[model samples]
Target chain A: MMQKRTIEIGVGVFVAAGIAALVMLAMKVSNLAAFTNQQGYEVTARFDNIGGLKERSAVTVAGVRIGRVKSIVFDDKDYEAVVTMNIESQHDRLPADTSASILTAGLLGEQYVALEPGGDEAFLKPGGDIKLTQSAIILEKMVGQFLFDKAAGGDGKKEEGAAP
Target chain B: MMGWLQRLGSTSLSVFERLGRGNLFLLRILAALPSLVLRPGLVIAQLYSVGVLSMTLIVISGLNVGMVLGLQGYNTLVDFGSEESLGQLVALSLVRELGPVVAALLFAGRAGSALTAEIGLMKATEQLSGMEMMAVDPLKRVVAPRFIAGIISMPLLAAMFSAVGVLGGFFVGVGLLGVDSGAFWSQMQSKVDLYDDILNGVIKSIVFGCVAAWIAVFEGYDAVPNTEGVSRATTRTVVHTAFAVLGLDFILTALMFGDE
Candidate 1:
């Protein structure tokens, strides 16, 4: 058996180590900083279709994350998806005419909103609507379009040959 | 046939009786908790035994588990050309499932069994009766401190296990396997949510801690006063804790991560 003082010191060290581990987990493993940063402005952009564009998806400028999609609500009046974005205050200088397009990170990855700045002196304010917005490119729709074009091209060649 | 029927009935009655007694024991522990506040030294001593003593096992196992995950994750993900996601894979799996479950299992084996044996031996040697005779209340003096120690140490140990495990994964993934260190960390940071993953894991560990401590103390207190009884109680502690932890883990995972 050890001395009482030694046991006490050992316990104190053990507790401190455990707390340090939790802190390390928060800082190194999880995006705790991003989750707690609430001092940001909200902006809305309407898309015709938002495929897999979920809430909290990254809103990036030139592939750099500057904001996140705060919420996604359907505009029943305009029949479009109204996406609310929370942009960091540091990124408040985005051009009024900046175009927003939904983009994928990789060949098959999460969808995010990408901003392309236009030549406009005015900056987009909080709650302002972005008029130039491109909807997400649905993979199924693209595949169907490609098959339809191929069949039409093949038929066109057959028709030309028969006419000749 | 009559004797067999009587035996089955008696067994069922004993099972219910045991459950009732366990509940009563837990209530008594709760009642005796205030005594711990008065004598913090007792709890501290138990903490040294339960938490500090188990540190080596937890840290080593954590590293081993993480390295294995990194190697296996890299192998499977390399074919898909998504090896960069190895950090995310390791972090998510560790935080969400393996860390708490495995750590709790180890704690039950290392500390739970020991607690049961110690208390059982004390009972077998009539230490508890001695305390009772002196009006010291063994529940407040002996059992409460050990129970409190197990609860306090469980979550901390699990967190340590995960933190060390992540470092192990980093070593194998970036240090040896030539993965881009920036991508490894950045991917993990971007994907893991604090509330969804870390907080959920903490909740699981806390619950597991309570389950393990409760079973250990109860088994010890209820053990028959003999050498064989003490041995049997210790064995039962490990076995029962394993079943409870694994079963509760499945239920918790389904509750927390089912929709996600």
Candidate 2:
């Protein structure tokens, strides 16, 4: 009987430990639990190319995350990516004329929205859109353009030399 | 040459025969699983012995492994000037691969060997035969509970392993090495995905548990009724479980993360 009680207690502890581990895992991996009830205001921004910018990516002001990308949708009429950001209440003092740019952490890492505040007395409302926005830079496209320019310049120089 | 061919054929045939028998034994244990609810005491006892007893080693090894990852990862990432990502590296490695695989290996070594030995000893002493004589189904009464207990305990043990490993990484990265504590945690939270990394790991551990428990119980049930036979069966249980766990881990990883 004593052994039976001890075994029961052991099983209980084992189960509790399992639950605790699972809770910790969910928190550590998802990161959603922490901000589920966060008081925030949503703002929109338009960009030509969002690239690999994912929802839930951080929105940073001066390298500190103040919010997250709430959702993303494509504006078919304007042919642009419409990104919605949920800024925490504490960061509600962002100016109306602030510019948002998609920036990558490290060289080839996750993309986030970096906000640069402007010197404006007006503050951004909950549904206000940030008109000044910069899209993600595609490395391959940039490299291709650089090579094309170099080849084009070399061809012109060679043709001038041949004519002379 | 004909004699050699005959020997090879016979050996292959025997191997297939053993495999078939092992499958049948596993089927019997699984078929008796429904009856386990009626014998909760038996299952609980097995759970205590298998799961609870194995916790200490799992936690200790998990912490040590995490610390090693933290130290190594910090050194490497510091070279790249991205030591802030130490938590991400440690958490991803532990949750995705080492946590499940290492915990399962340890389980096989600690609890699996003990299970095989216990059941094999019971067979050698004719306890199984006696149970049969008493009209009790030895597989249902003895083996089913243990199999279920192992299956249930495996995922829990693996989760515990990962949690402790993360804590260990935290200690080495933040407390000892002067890494910014907030970056260590926030980086991990932002990088690791629940469905991709953590859930997949839990699935791996669960599958490993099933394989290890199946091998252990089957080996014991099929052991020859002698001291030597019992010892050999226990050894085979450890060897077979290790191979099965490792092989299954590769296949699962491919299926889970292959596209990425």
Candidate 3:
């Protein structure tokens, strides 16, 4: 009976440890526990094209992540991507004229919102909008435009050669 | 001229007959499952033998696989100048695929085969029959606890396997290979989502546990009362468990990640 009791306790301990490890792994992998319950205020930014910007993407100021993109919605009236950002309350003293841009990390990495603070005495409130916004740079569109210009130049050169 | 066709027809019929019988056995075990709550001691003993005993094997294999992933992932990512993504690659692969599948395979080989052999021996020795004759249902008294223990143990074991494997990856990536520790962990944290990757893997392990335990118990109960029959049943348990796990994995992956 003593041996059986010992075995039972051992099994119980083993199972508890397994569960604890699972919870830790989930917390570490998801990164939800880091910022989900953080006290923050929301601010809106409107962009012509949000590109691949996703909800939960980091919102960084001067290379430090202050919060995340809370949501991305399309405003039918303005035909723009209206992104809601939740910035930490600790960083709430940003100037009203701060500019927000959709920026990519590394060269081909994930997209984030980069904020550039401007010189202003007044601060933006929770519901305030950041009017100055830069949309994500679409690499494919830029490449296509470059190719089109090259093709047009080549055609003009052919026409000049024919005239000569 | 018709011999080959007759042989094929009979073989297919026998396969269906065996499948039907297996389902019936599973139903019987399910019926007996409620009796387990009354026999907590029996369940605990079985859990010890099946789950706790198997931990050493699961941990060792998990660690080794993680180390290999770190080494291979590092080598591959370095080519693309993305060695920083090594943690993400290792964690994602292990959590999504390797941890559950490999741990289930090992469980089937270790605890699963043992269950078959032990149950087979009891049947061959007429112990199950003796209990049946005494008005105790062998399915409840003998089979149900073991089955419940197996089903309970599997997900926990798989979780342990994944956790240990990640630690192993950290050791290899940071300690041995000189990879940035911060990059390895932070990248993994950012990339692996809770719902999309980790929870789905846990669900897979639960299904695998049910399938493997079901196969092990049924194979043992159905084995003929002889040495040769017991050995044959044990072999079939391992082979069928592997095939079922792999086939189910493919179906689950397609269902979970497939584009609508």
- Per prediction, the TM-score for chain B is 0.98, 0.98, 0.97
DockQ of structure 3? 0.65
> What lDDT tens digits, residue by residue, belong to model 3 across residues A1-164?
89988898889987996797689679876565765767899999999999889998999999999998999999999899999999998998999999999988887898999999999999989989999999998999989999999999999999999996
**Local lDDT at A19 for model 2:** 73
Please state the error at residue A155 of candidate 2 in Å: 17
Per residue, candidate 3 scores C-alpha lDDT tens digits across B95-155 of: 8899889999999999999999999999999999999899999999889998998888888
Stretches > 4 Å off in candidate 3: A144-164
Residue B40: error of model 1 in Å?
A: 0.4
| Chain A TM-score across all models, in listed order | 0.92, 0.87, 0.87
Q: For residues B1-260, what per-residue lDDT tens digits would candidate 1 score against the true structure?
A: 99999999999999999989999999999999997888998999999999999999999999999999999999998998889999999999999898999999999999999999999999999999999999999999999999999999999999999999999999999998988999999899989988899999999999999999999999999999999999999999999999999999999999999987
Clashes of each: 0, 0, 0
On a 0 to 100 scale, what is the lDDT of residue B234 in model 2?
87
DockQ of 2: 0.58
List, for all models, the DockQ compared with the true complex: 0.91, 0.58, 0.65
TM-score, one value per model: 0.97, 0.85, 0.93
Tens-place lDDT digits, model 1, residues A79-99: 999999999988899999999
Of models 1 and 2, which has the larger DockQ?
A: 1
Please list the residue runs of candidate 1 whose C-alpha ends up more than 4 Å from where it truly belongs after superposition.
Answer: A161-163
Best by lDDT: 1
